[model samples]
Target: MTAPPKTPHPLLFAPAASQGSVPDTEIGRLFHEMDWSATPLGPVEVWPQSLRIAVSIALNSRFPMFVWWGSELVNIYNDAYIPVLGKRHPQAFGGRAREIWNEIWPVLGPQVDEVMQHGRATWNERVLLVMERNDFTEETYFTWSYSPVYDDQGGIGGLFCACSEETPRVRVERERDALLQRAQGTVTTLQGWFDNAPGFVAVLRGPDFVFEMVNRAYYQLVGHRPIEGRPAFEALPEVRSQGFIEILERVYREGEPFIGRGLRLILQKEPGGPLSEAFVDLVYQPVFDVHGRVSGIFAQGHDVTEQVRAVEALKEGDRRKDEFLATLAHELRNPLAPIRQSAKLVKTPGLTAAQHHWAIDVIDRQATHMALLLDDLLDVARISRGRLELRMEPVALSSVVASAVETAQPLIEAKRHRLSVTLPAEPVVLTADPLRLAQVLSNLLSNAAKYMDDGGAIEVQAQARPGAVAIRVRDNGIGVAQESLQTLFQMFSQVSSALQRAEGGLGIGLALSKGLVEMHGGSIEAHSDGLGRGAEFVVHLPWMQTESLEGGQPEAPQGQAALRRKVLIADDNHDASTTLAALLELDGHEVHTASTGNEALALAEQLRPDIAILDIGMPGRNGYQVASEIRRADWGRGMTLIALTGWGQAEDRRQAVAAGFDEHWTKPVDTDTLQALFATPGRAGSSQAGPAR
Candidate 1:
């Protein structure tokens, strides 16, 4: 059988070797020695040299590959192609196609056979192949081109393929699609919510720019149809003439936002008709682009016409209240002045004992009424500002009650009411302002007298408790209505509806008493069954340790004789000057009266009076000017200058000192204090001068 040399396949020998030339390398010699015709069908001798060279070039050219031929598949390539086959090794080169590529064989082997059977080329084909290279691992996904090799007779032979793994690129594309879908959905939801928002919204470009986007509320406010891509002045031409254009231009140049409150704007609807009006509180905010450059502006606002009108009405009401107070003070004080002066004048000299007592009683009664009115005025001013201060001390409840009853005796007697007073056998002491306690008692007694039409009894009682003292004033008179009880202590608010009744007052007594009591760390309450059943007011104050009592020396008797001296009294009011001069004269001092500042100045220079009393409100020149001139004069330097006026504010006292007055006294001057002033000797009088300006 070996007699005839076996014919080798043309693919197995080198071209030069087939021409009878010898190869130089050992591999070449080994190739020549092998008998290809006698070898097994699946042996390595069947692999062509051309096939090996082609695979090496493909793997070295930056592309990965593998080959299958007639039931055998091999990774006959360079180093770069080896790892792509995963666990498959060089030993797998001659293995059966099923054994080497078991994971991908089911799909890949059939496709390769299909190309070879048809003798056609498959190009740019994509496939998902989960292939196991070794027993341990799998790889998926491929894109490849397959071409069938043809014999010279055009018979199907093998498949030539090239592949690229594309699993990472496919996954990345799918995830990107999902994120884009979510972002689009979120944007749609945000737009829906913003459109239905309650507040007006608009996007503008610069100050006078038209709204690029607007919500429903913005349309309702502007009324006019909006022109989207135009400036504000172009759409609403009236704005140019209304000064809005200038405001916009300035804001754009300055890059500042503008916020305005209660701005009134007029809008035009049509020709030859009244304009539409609006009061707005508006805010402008500068808008920035992603690069942080100012690109536009946003505007929002509320219509406040109704609110502005309401505030104007409130201010008008406040003005009327102030006017009423001024008028009341003027009208009330005019009549009070004459009555007060007449009472004082009636107390003068030489009368029968009965007449003297009658005159004194009349004077006391009128003075008390005037004092009560003045007190009410002061209380209202102080309470309104929360400036009332209480001078708290250990007070004797019984003594305060006694003094109040004595003060109100005339009123009680005039009404013919019986008064009863009850006090603890032991002293009832309370921590309170003594003067304020007396004031509270006097107010209650006065209120009771004013309310009662006929004679009625008033009973006052004081009792001590473990930690507090209680004082009660009970009156048998017309009582407060159930509805009015809650508001009885409100200032300027009267309980009785009858305006023409005998109770003529500013309705501040009870209110002031309540404030004073609370300030002393005490409380007061009013109780009544119903109208006309009678009323009771109870005051409770905390008890504190009592301090030792030192009875103050009895105030020196007023009207005491002093060395007679020439005294000039200057006052604008004739009655005040005359009454003051009369009182000084009775105190054994020679007195002269001047109703004008110039007259007083001339008199002081002429008479060289020992003392000068100047009124601040005199005509020609005020008392301050008169006093300055008198002090500067040679003859008037020795004379004492006293300011006598109704101006009692701290600033007024300061001005008096600046004007060179030796002393300052408020009007309805305390006669006793004045008398004591004249009686005291030396420069002690100068000590009473007020603060310098």
Candidate 2:
């Protein structure tokens, strides 16, 4: 019931007639010849295996090969195509090329079919393709070259293809393309950011170091069109003449980045024209190419014009500060010298009552002047730092003005200038700080007197304006400059250069006065024509009344009887001790003198004086030590200890208080206050003594 398969005859292996039959024609012989030894065909069997051998040889070859039949992709074979097919078996021998790889049909099928139909050959490179293999997997690359195959009848039968598998090459090429695209995008973004950056940026290239790229700011700064692709020397030839080209050359040669800040660059519109200068901070960084070869330089910078100007302003302020301090020291020391000399002269032991009284008064007035100067200095510092404290009270404007005038009278008398005052008969009241008001008026008056040369006249007048009171201080003195008017209220800002030499000041007085006036809801203004003319300052303050009026009377004056008691003075300076003793004696007080704190303490315990004035700085046992010893003494119960020294700082006063002194007074003591302290009713004529400097 089963059928057996038949076996082939041995004779069938022998060469057949088709294999042995050689063509007599040259074309037939050529087609049948096997020139390659690796081919699996004998010379006689080549004809029968011609088509098969040709197809096999083409498949094994490195070149891509395909066959098309008239407008249709029939067969394709290639060694390079093996990998593209991945793990797929070679069973794809006779499939429709288009159907197997339809994804690439749009590009490869259309072009190859056209060549076959038209009987022509076409070649291309970098031709793109996306196709699926026999396994239905996607592949993307390029295919090229199409040659039409003709039949024996001279008609186009099919097309043969030879191409290189460009997938790897194409992928690499796409990556390179992406890198270039990204680089371009980065450059664009950098350009935009640099254009608006606070600093300038530029790119320079070439042996001549020309500017190749410049941002918007660079163009604006250069004030000219960019010179791209031009040599730096040629584009900015003027720089060569100005030595800037040399700097660039040095940087380039060293292959190092260079940075320069606060460099002054003067740019002129035309040669020999006035230079418009600007300060700049700059950096030049070397740029390299793909091969790491130096290609050009990139420069970035900032314009520091404003910064330079501000520094100049600060320098000017420092200069004014120095000048003011020097003037202050000179003015304060001048009065101290006379007070010391007069105090020494009064101690000669032959002084009459009138002469002694005059000497005491002179010492008192000079001491007060020094105190006022120190007060002004402290007030200026406080106002500058916004630390000025005001004691607000209902004040009579007349009293404030009168006090200020009285304080300035010595300076006025020294100048012998005509002084006039005009005040309303009716009282003008204001809710203000009395001491600060007096200080403001005093500063204005003193400033006027200091500026006037040869004792010029001064006028102080006040009037009621709409909702305010206007106080005017007019003086015939060297006037301020027009250019300085705007900065008149600026601290440490002096007048123009011309006026600084004529009238010296720290430039803080007016500034402090202005701030004080404004803090009280008021404004101040300065008016002047020019130098050698006159200046007038006007202060306008709001007029307001305080509600409370009780407890407004001035305190009664202290008596001078205590000042007439015997007083002992001790100090290291013989002139200081002797003059102080004589000055006390002139107040109708018996005086004894010692040259040291120990001597004064000894005399104080033995004499049991009413008061003791101690000098802080002494050779042995300083006045503070002396005062402490005296306060602890059995006879020191009612004795008042006063500190009189050059150490006038606030902390010094606090230390003095802690050391048991009743009051602290600086050197060049005001004789009037000293006399009044001694003259108090309960304390007057009591035995009091003081330590001297």
Q: How displaced is residue 444 in candidate 2, in Å?
A: 1.6
TM-score, each model? 0.50, 0.59
lDDT scores of the candidates, listed in order: 0.68, 0.70
In model 1, the runs with Cα more than 4 Å from the true position are 1-371, 386-395, 428-436, 465-468, 497-500, 551-565, 595-610, 619-621, 624-641, 654-663, 670-673, 679-693
**Candidate 2 per-residue C-alpha lDDT over 128-233 given as tens digits, one digit per residue, 9 for 90 to 100:** 5655554565556665677766654677666666767687987797899999999999988887887777677888895578777777777666666446677766
- Candidate 1 per-residue lDDT, tens place, 537-571, comes to 99887775454335732445555566566789988
Worst 10 residues of 2 by lDDT: 19-28
Question: Model 1: which residue pairs collide?
Answer: none
Evaluate model 2: give its TM-score: 0.59
Candidate 2 residue runs with Cα over 4 Å from true position = 1-77, 86-166, 185-199, 202-277, 280-392, 409-433, 450-470, 484-525, 540-550, 553-643, 653-662, 675-693
- The top-ranked prediction according to lDDT is 2
